[model samples]
Target: MQQTEEHHSYARATWQVVEPYHGAVYFSPEAHARYEELGADNRAGYFASRGAALGPASAELVIGTFYNFNPDLVHRALPAAWQAASPQRFLAARLAGIDATLHRVLGPEIGSAEMLRAAELAQQAARTALRHPQGRPLFAAHAALPWPDEPHLVLWHAQSLLREFRGDGHVAALLAAGLDGIEALVTHAATGAIAAEALRTSRGWSPEQWTQAVQRLCERGWLEQGPDLALTPYGRERRQAIERTTDELADLPYAVLGQASCAELRRLARPFSLALARELLPWAVDRLAAVAD
Candidate 1:
């Protein structure tokens, strides 16, 4: 139990440092500039640049994992973007986007240097961590990809890969325990990151679809019936178990870092994450708070 808790703490801290990059990339001017150069708009550019790193994967591959954007949104973006530019071109655009965003947000200073150093430490740790069992398809594919030469880019890509590694594992764990995508999302909504209504709207699930999911969970004794939509005791236990499993799966990389090294990575990365929250992208902070909750 204690080991699990320790792993959870390290995983949470690591995520805090890197999570901003995942969301802020969509909002950054640098990312926009790179997208424009690629002859794609923000939505298509985002879908292409990020998806390109995975190779010319199908929309089903993308929608099932990686992105939380509605399936319709992704379908509209892909092949169109691919037709406009090859995956290699988009991959280059993706790196350029990250570079521009980080530079614009962090600027040239000790701050940028520290973030790069943190990325190096994280990449080293993740390299050690990925030696463990990973069952998720997306993570497996990403883990086999080449590492970037630049420390900052290495950090972003490393962290991104690690995040996906854990996410893919979590999805596997969720499925093993019998929660489908909508059920998983509904359970997550119980955490209050975004309202239930917002989750339904954002994911483009119809009201009937959302209601049916809730009913299915209720039938399984995971959630209570009717308007309130609260989790039963079983529901809470199941949710916690899924989270615990995910943390355990995510632990090896941090374990390779050891307690002291994990602490140092957190120390180095925390201020930069905080600066990102305060100076440039408060939405990242808000999202972090939701995830932490």
Candidate 2:
């Protein structure tokens, strides 16, 4: 086995794309918001545990890879097949399905340099030198890839592999709003209720701003629209946990931004001449708990 720590491979065929372990690292603005909320609630631990693992949907990807499922399965399956095939047939089968399939992971054409590179990385990581039902294969490979899209195949495959290595099972019932309308509209009542209260007591926002925001979310199906705004079941589910995330994080000490809500806080308060002063610095960590000092 070539230990990456001792001898790194720069060959394109040797590496794969990578994503961060925690789902919060999805790294979108919304994801950043979620991370902030979770951090404030002292829930960084939730991510700490899964730091380099796959996201919530990892299981499905795993089962798919093992079973040769999904549209791209054949291409994925082919390289591994070649690896295990007899030496005589290896080269002949090397480019199997190269022309027949359009792989989203590898792009529409398998003939591309990128596609070949991916096949090589996956082969080196899991297939090449594979010993059938028994021994752990040596000559392994590794790569840090980008985050997979929701329901992504390669991402799922990578996650499954990680879980097996660690003997960890990624299971949880945290509610996820499909954020699509097919879901029941009634779930968010509680969260909407919370939002409504927040809005009512909200100091800077105008009725129109709050109402417009709520209405926009309602139209987008983030919350249920009604005579009085409230969360749908989905919203309820997320709200319950998101708020808990804040409290969980609050165990650490943070000076409340006096009265500043999240919106009012921003990174690098460079405009404030007193930002260097301990007392007047406007920054707050994610939560009252989880202080870095």
Candidate 3:
């Protein structure tokens, strides 16, 4: 226990030096209390992407993604806020509203009771968040931490959990590849084919590390060694699945969520979807800027 404590002490110092914003959020009294009640094991209210937080920007995006990612949790955590117009909600309600609206505007017409309400709330939030002058700095601060080299930690984690829950081996394998960085390379190639050798040098991967990534994809038959090789039919399908999700998220922007007042726009979800798309594209750009090795 003494040794473990020492390691955490060291980690805290290192984290603060490199990622100070995290220190502020993690040490917040309310955040610690919330995590304690939620429990470390189940990790409710805790984020897979950025862990727990309190500030509005982090709260809105991270908390919003939580509910947006898992519809079932909507009722469990913020039922009153999303389900009805009563006074009871937080970051999750506003985010969920955005997610539901984006989906409706893009796909599917079979709306759930909660979904219809979600659409309404998104528009109200997006417009208000965008219009507020003072809301700019506060909204920008909600931004995520620097993404790792593979920009797929949360995406891969959520997909992996979903596969485990539904027992989907095919996708489980694909998500595994994503986390390991093998999948992202091939996907990036099919889209535009970034020069792998140059990318490796810039990312500072060892020759072996780069080779192994290629080898992993090769073993799965998604890639092969050749003068001008490319992905297979099976590989395209898996990559397509990932691209589709990104395409969906690309439709919403964070700024709209930042300054928007959920109370004022309890029913304007549809128009909000377009505004959100613009926000999401820029947000993704920001995260990719800090991707780690």
Q: How far is candidate 1 from the true structure (C-alpha RMSD, Å)?
A: 3.2
- TM-score of predicted model 1? 0.85
lDDT of 3 at 124: 31
Candidate 3 lDDT, 133-226, residue by residue in tens:
2322323223222221221122212222222122222233345446343345444554444666554553335667656766777788766556
lDDT of each: 0.73, 0.28, 0.34
Q: Give the root-mean-square deviation of each candidate in angstroms.
A: 3.2, 20.4, 20.2
Question: What is the Cα-based TM-score of model 2?
Answer: 0.21
lDDT of 2 by residue, 1-293 (tens): 32232122111101111211112122223333333333311122112212212222132333332221222322333333323323223211211111111132233333444333333333323222122212111101112223233222332333323322212110111122232111222233334322434323322234564566567667765576677656666566665564343232221111121112111211111111121121221222112112111
Q: What pairs collide in candidate 1?
A: none
TM-score: model 3 vs. ground truth: 0.30
Q: Candidate 2, 113: how far from true, in Å? A: 76
Candidate 1 lDDT by residue in tens digits, 1-293: 23667677866667666666555566667777877887889878877876776777778778877534567777888878888888888777776777777776667632466776788788987787567534667777667768877776777777877777778878877877798777888888876555788777766678888889999999999987878868889998999899888877777777667777777777776655665676567756665444431
After the best TM-score superposition of candidate 2, give how far the Cα of residue 114 lies from its true spot, in angstroms: 70
- Of the candidates shown, which would achieve the greatest lDDT relative to the real structure? 1
